[model samples]
Target: MIRFYHAPGTRGIRPIWLCEELGIDYGVEMIEFTKEFRASPAWRKISPLGKVPVLVDTADDLLMYESCAMVQYLLDRYGNGQLQPQLGTPEHAIYQQWNWFAESTFARPLGEIVNHGREFPGENLIPAVVAEMQNRGEQCAIAVGEAIADKAFILGDNFSAADINLGYSIMLAERFLSNGLPESIKPYWQRLSSRPAFIRATR
Candidate 1:
């Protein structure tokens, strides 16, 4: 069985959702972000960064980090080519494109917002940084919305790892939308929230 060390509302959701999609047997160990948990030597051993969503492939004792990499690895190892597009195909290229975009472009900016907000809560100087991050996230959201506006999934017709990657960004955007979001991104959030896998993952 695979062991997943995760935290709620974090990147851990990516692999957890993938596990559900693959119907794979896995064990989840939730890690609290408290000082005590962060200070644990054992947890630090598994993830030097002390981040959640670390997967221990017990069979081979492989420890993996980074949500996108883990999701891609799981799909490649266990999905039997079901949820991933064929390499060298057009669909595969698109899949790889959005997969990287979600992390580098979309999630990175949004994370900056949360990190800045938390690090400097109510600090006047930090508001500018937060606003900049918010703008970047909006741009990313619009791009994602445009890509999936006509299709049901990111990769043409079938659901693929790209969806898993981008879908998580869409979900994160929804949390911020309640406060305020770019008008162009509303429908995109709706489409992602309506997916069955998203519903299951949220629950």
Candidate 2:
């Protein structure tokens, strides 16, 4: 069995949604977001950083914590080419590009915004830093928005795991920034968010 350690509204949702879409049976251990949980010795072994998205595949005794890596693992092991392009293809290259773009290029700024805003709110909020992160996050959002705007999914006609990876970041940006998102991006999010798998995974 696969065990997904997750918290509501965390990046762990990405892999959880992928599991649902692929019809893979898995168990979720919902960890509450708190200092106590973050400091737990057992969780520390699973995720040295105490992140919510820790995947332990008891079947193989494999432990993974990175959200993007976990999503790719599930797809590679179970997708059977359903939502991914075959390796060595042009589409597969583009898929790889989007996966990296979603996490490193896009999720970085959004994460900064979330951390700063939450750790320092109201009068303590750093106007300049938040503004910078929001600006960067918005730019990344525009690129994603334009890419997925005319299509039903990220890779045009197919609903690929790239959408799952990118879609979760979009949700995070929307939750934190909540202002001046590219008008084009909002509808793309609506489309992804309404998916039964997305709904079920987050719930």
Candidate 3:
């Protein structure tokens, strides 16, 4: 069995959702983000940076971090090709494209929005930063929207691991939609958020 170290309401939601989707018999070890929890020696051994979503592959004695990587790994190892595209194929190219975009373009700006919002709440500068972030987020959302517009999922008919990564990225950005998100981005978020996997992940 794999041991997943996670904190609720954090990025760990990505892998937790993947685990649930794959029907893997994984153990969830909840690690609160409180000062006391952060200082735990055991948790530190798993994640030196004290981040959530650290996956301990007990069989191989491998500890994996990063939500996207964990999701991809789970799909590759346990999904039995159900949620991954064939390598070097067009679908695989698109999978990598959107997955990288979600992590680099979407997740980064969205994180900046959250970080700056918390660091400078109610200040003029925070709003300005949020606006810039929202603009970047909107661009990424548009790209994702166009990709999934006519299809039911990001990979066009299948809910791939890329969807899990990008879907969560969209969800993170949606929390700040009231700040400066363009009207065009709403339906994209609605589509991603309405997925059964997304609903189960949040719960």
Per-residue lDDT of candidate 1, residues 56-156 (tens digit)? 89787789989999998888888888788788998788788889998888898788777676667674447667677777777788787677668777776
Runs of candidate 2 exceeding 4 Å displacement:
178-180
Q: Across residues 85-166, which tens digit of lDDT does each residue of candidate 2 receive?
A: 9999999999989999999999999888877877898999989998898888888998988887688788898889999999
Q: Identify the candidate with maximal lDDT.
A: 2
Lowest lDDT 10-mer window, candidate 2?
173-182
TM-score of each: 0.90, 0.93, 0.84
Ranking by TM-score: 2, 1, 3
Alpha-carbon lDDT, every model: 0.78, 0.88, 0.76
TM-score of 2: 0.93
lDDT of 3 by residue, 1-203 (tens): 78887776678778877777777778888877775676688767778866677898878777898888888887778788877789889989989888888888888988888778656767445567778888888788777767666787777777777877887787777676555444555665676677676677677
lDDT score at residue 173, model 2, on the 0-100 scale: 84
Q: Scored by Cα lDDT, where does model 3 land?
A: 0.76
88, model 1: CA deviation in Å?
A: 2.3
User: Cα deviation in Å at residue 11, candidate 2?
Assistant: 0.6
Ranking by lDDT: 2, 1, 3
